[model samples]
Target: MGSLGSRVLRRKAGLPRGEAAAAGKGGKRKRGGAEGTGDSDSDGEAEREERLLHLRGRRKKLKSTSKYIYQTLFLNGENSDIKICALGEEWNLHKIYLCQSGYFSSMFSGSWKESSMNVIELEIPDQNIDVEALQVAFGSLYRDDVLINPSRVVALLAAACMLQLDGLIQQCGETMKETITAQTVCAYYNSAGTYGLDSVKKKCLEWLLNNLMTHQSVGLFKELSINLMKQLISSSNLFVLQVEMDVYTALKKWMFLQLVPSWNGSFKQVLTEADAWFAERRREFGGDISFLESAQGSAFLPVFAHLRLQYIISDLASARIVERDALLPSEWLSSVYKQQWFAMLRAEQDNDTGPQEINKEELEGNSMRCGRKLAKDGDYCWRWTGFNFGLDLLVTYTNRYIIFKRNTLNQPCSGSVSLQPRRSIAFRLRLASFDCSGKMICSRTTGYQILTLEKDQEQIVMNLDSRLLTFPLYICCNFLYTSPEKRADSEAQLDHLES
Candidate 1:
């Protein structure tokens, strides 16, 4: 028997032991000395070498194209010091590419990198952009300084605005304006408004109105265009109307005459004519008459008056944003009309007992005292006139209790609501709250303080959150809450009532 290890020797992996073993799996065997075996092995090795060479060539091309970015963004040679800037950074080409590709995010966010990155670097990141390929695609259209086409400048400026690059956006806007006409300005009026470009809106409105004035009228039928006219009127204030007086007057006259026998427009025209009649009446009365006051004789007047007052107050508020600077400072005097109304109502209602007067003089004195107290409380003192929900109610109900007490720890005021009583007066006062929603809700108290005036009425109703109550408070407080000066004046005026 061959050795039990014969199979093991047959499986040996190195060079063949004899000539018969040199032939592949099943070929005929050639028996010779070691020279024949050597020649056969050399042929096999040569073929293997050729295969590996082909694989290496393929791998080299794949690695070059797939792993490396081919796109290059060249910056100005003069601005080499600046390199690239994107999203508030300076970056090199490779880093920019990495950023564009998203590979640099971990690196960028890992620690603060001071490198300046360009817009392209910020935008494309790691994506390969072969310059040669881009140049071919662009042909003669490519410019050295700008990466985008001339036609896309507006879009680029818009992108700049989205990125919050104020300078770039403005520059683009100016450039477009320089190259275009009033037509472009008119086209973008709404866009300008959306952007809150007050200047742009002003200019666009001027252009549109000027053109309309030259035509003396749009000549559009009232039935077809009443809505458009209403929208235009609503978009602006008296100043805009005055500027486009010709247009406004024509529209107003046409609107006013719609109720006359010859009128033949849509329901909208009929409505405008009716509105003009009432507007003229309102103008003569200095404003709309209260439905309740007018209704003293008419059964419908009370409900109509209250509803009209609410509507007027709401309209006044909506008009504030557009009329901020247009109206005179003295017009602010009318702001407290509501507060005065409530105060007079309260004073008359409770006339049977308690210190009889809580009016302008007493309110002024108390406000001055409070101002002194506030001045002592912090480094800054703010006094405002107009309306404050809390202050107005405080002065109206418990006018005697309002006083100034300086809290001397020198700590800043927390500006929260408090009910502090001194002598016979109970002061339920709230410092302004920073929370916008919380600020809207005024407060009231029922329990008691040292000073109590009991009148046997139905009830001391204090639903401050009710719609009727809230709107009045809003009307009283909206302008007054603007500044400490206004609040101080209002307080002083109310304090005078006490004296």
Candidate 2:
């Protein structure tokens, strides 16, 4: 090596010959003398290239073309090629980015009068579309992703549908479906119907079916329209509480709210207020015509027709309420009484054991709907009141399991028990648990099945997993306790009406 002072001066200038020699020797030692300095130098080159590649990747990610384009081009309106005016607001936008929307593309590509214009005025017919929704809808064109807020989804959906933005429309539909609660379900359902979002509409209907009765609310009752109430009552999928009697009771409360929407009160007070209101109506009408036959109630007659009066009148208290309310026409009750009398005779004298097989049509139209709520994870047993054609089925919940017992001699029942050696009934069991917002946390269903039991026999209807068990579980059941009957009675009623 050269003198230390000279070597130091040369090192500062550039890699001198002496320093290169020293580095060569160090590389040989690191790679072993046999491999020489060539392999070591190649390793150094590879490491440097890898470091440069990582730096380039980080720089590219930081730039984020989507964000840059959105901020500069959309927000700053840089070099905008066209202008859009709607809902008393204006936007400076580029046609190239706007073409991502089908509406703008059609306008530009077609032989329309406004195709070549630098500014275009849009007609916004949907009342839901507002300025904020239009801003978000326009901004989404330049951004790679859009964040949807549940509260603003309806308005955004209206804007997207008007602009024919399929991706944004689909996102809005997904957001609505995911956010459905008692407060939002009716609005979502109505918007879905208007926008032709079939999947979202179906999801809203399912949520309503599960929660309408299991978790009733004054807001929901007020929101439910006459036509929607008709649809819900006419379907077997409705989750009724207690029995058919409870369904009529709910309708009476709902009808009261429909008429007196401003009368806000506690849930327990609904029935008392409804009775008082109807009593006033009775006095006004001179108490001669039934409420359902009168002008005010005739509009709801179609909904009431779906109630299985045979099940409702089986209990003395319920029948008495039906008589006292005078909601149904006297002829309506008389006809149901005659039909049920024959059915009772068939069960007692004709040896009608019960339903032998599941008749989907018969069950969907006339099944006895009922439900119960389990407060926590524990052992409990209960029974719904009504004759149930003397089947006397009892429901039990314990150890995360639901059991259905046929009471004959092992357990005392409120109603008469069938003494037959074996009896069959068609049933469908459903259980669900909800979060604070009325969103379903977990749910299960038995669909539709037929179960046969010997005297005092019990069977496991549902086995809950420990992982999925939650407090305040609601269980709803649809039971068809009698065989399907001929349609002669219904046809005769229609015939009388036609005359």
Weakest 10 consecutive residues of candidate 2 by summed lDDT = 11-20
lDDT of 1 by residue, 357-440 (tens): 333333322221111112111123232222222222222222112222222123333332122221123322322111122122
For model 2, the superposed segments whose C-alpha errors exceed 4 Å read 1-63, 486-499
Each prediction's TM-score against the native?
Answer: 0.22, 0.86
Worst 10 residues of 1 by lDDT: 474-483
Q: Give the top-scoring candidate (lDDT).
A: 2
Give the alpha carbon lDDT tens digit for every residue of 304-405 in model 2. Answer: 888889889888899999999999999889998888787676666667777887789988987888888888878999888887767888899988889988
Superposed Cα deviation of residue 88, candidate 1 (Å): 26
Instruction: Note the Cα lDDT for every prediction shown.
Output: 0.33, 0.86
